[model samples]
Target: MASGFNQKNKQCSLQELAALVPDGSSIALGGSFLHRGPFAFVRELIRQEKRGLELIKQSPGYDVDILCRAGVLRRVRAGIVAMEGNFGLAPWYRRAVERREIELEEHACASLTAGLRAAAFGVPFQPCGGLHGSSLPELNGWKCLDDPYGSGQKTWVVPAIRPDFAVIQASEVDAQGNVRVHGTAHWDRIMSRAAGSVLVVAEKVVDSAVFEAQPESTLVPYFMVQNYAVVAGGAWPGSSWPAYAIDYPAVEAYMDKNSDLRAHMAAAPEAQEGNHG
Candidate 1:
């Protein structure tokens, strides 16, 4: 079990957190496009020059694009990678897929979530009817199995996706490492439970008593969190709702300057020191 207060006192740098993730490990990122993602941590991962990471997510944005462009990823299993609204497609991700730079596994969002849910419960697989009559099963090698009980109905069985690590950004975390997600949590909760290890970046950290005062707000208990750190504005450029809104101008600037990805990355704000515990 993780020692909550002890871990809270031993906060390390973001670099140290990034270093904890080894090369070639499958990693699940939190949030949808431009919403509550750990963008700063993704930047640190790139800064550390990590490589051969396998990324898993529902819908990704700049976080995954940066990693893909940095040549840090070996494969990506995602439902989609659009920029949401009028932002259209994520340019770098689209280019990477077009160029075949990284292997891609496209699964339906429901199937992907189901797989993670199964993993969280320590199940081998989850049966779903969502992929029926779709090419995804054949494309991703999902098995179509028949129901054993009298009914001859078939279901697509999505294998569990237990990642090596899950990195999530939260609205708040108590000293005991209980996380609170203010808005739509996306897949963070399930991914945290499904991964072998979990790391969280929070906009604020308060006393454990705060959670005790409002227990329903605690989305992830301390036992599920292996490590956590308070990183104000940690999501930067991506919105961490109820705390900060999306940096639209910054995103626009990024889109305009995206052709020089390395240069833009080099100019990104430095991550804070105390980012891991």
Candidate 2:
């Protein structure tokens, strides 16, 4: 559980980040839709022409669509995959899955979070009794088998998801990589702790003292942060909230223009640039 930013901060690049990720590696990502995505880092991945990464997003948006369009991702485990709306309907993802261009393991949003929580807490598995009598079981590929405990209701078991790495974006971070997620945190902390390694992209790096003075504001401690870089406008063309403004017109343009997932992915900037990290 080593903390703090890597010693070679300035020396690190998105290419180095790509080295930590491998083909078909399962990745848990931060943000909900376009909210807090590690856009610059992800763009760097696309720029590097990285490929074959597997992504697990609870609520994906352009980040997932862009990667898929770049052909950098091969598989996805997600609750919802779309680029439209704030946290719903990733048209690009839906198109890709429907066209059989990628493999998808879908689950309910709450179940996805619960499973991630179990992994972060070091649990072997999470019994999803909460999904009983819901459409989630069918969507997740779980059969309506008899309950062993005879609870009189079917139970779906969601396996723990311990991702190889979790990539996130935040409003601020100290030089040591202690992240503070302002406003809605979504599941940034859960993804950070559950993954084997964590990479964060911050808008700015403040003094370590600033973090220490207000420890409660720290959402993810440096202890869990493996690699961190200061990336301004990292979540640009999306929403970064108080740190920056959302590119509403851009988002709207993306939604209005693309009818299918592949087309949307094809339209992603990263796809043309050829990076996915």
Top-lDDT structure, candidate number: 1
Top-TM-score structure, candidate number: 1
Q: Please, what is the TM-score per model?
A: 0.92, 0.82
In candidate 1, what are the lDDT values of residues 5-107, reduced to their tens digit?
5643434556677888998999999988999998888988888889989999999888888787788888999987877785777777777888999899998
* Model 1 ranges with Cα > 4 A deviation: 1-10, 257-259, 266-277
Give the Å shift of residue 54 in candidate 2.
1.3
Native-referenced Cα lDDT, model 2: 0.73
Residue clash pairs of candidate 1: none
**Relative to the unseen true structure, what is the Cα RMSD of model 1?**
2.6
lDDT of 2 by residue, 1-277 (tens): 1345456553145557656676667888888777878876776677667788888878877888878767888888888666655545766667788888888777777778777887988886666666766776776665445678787866567778888999988888876667887889888888887889888877777777787788888888876778776666678667787867677766766666344544433554334443332
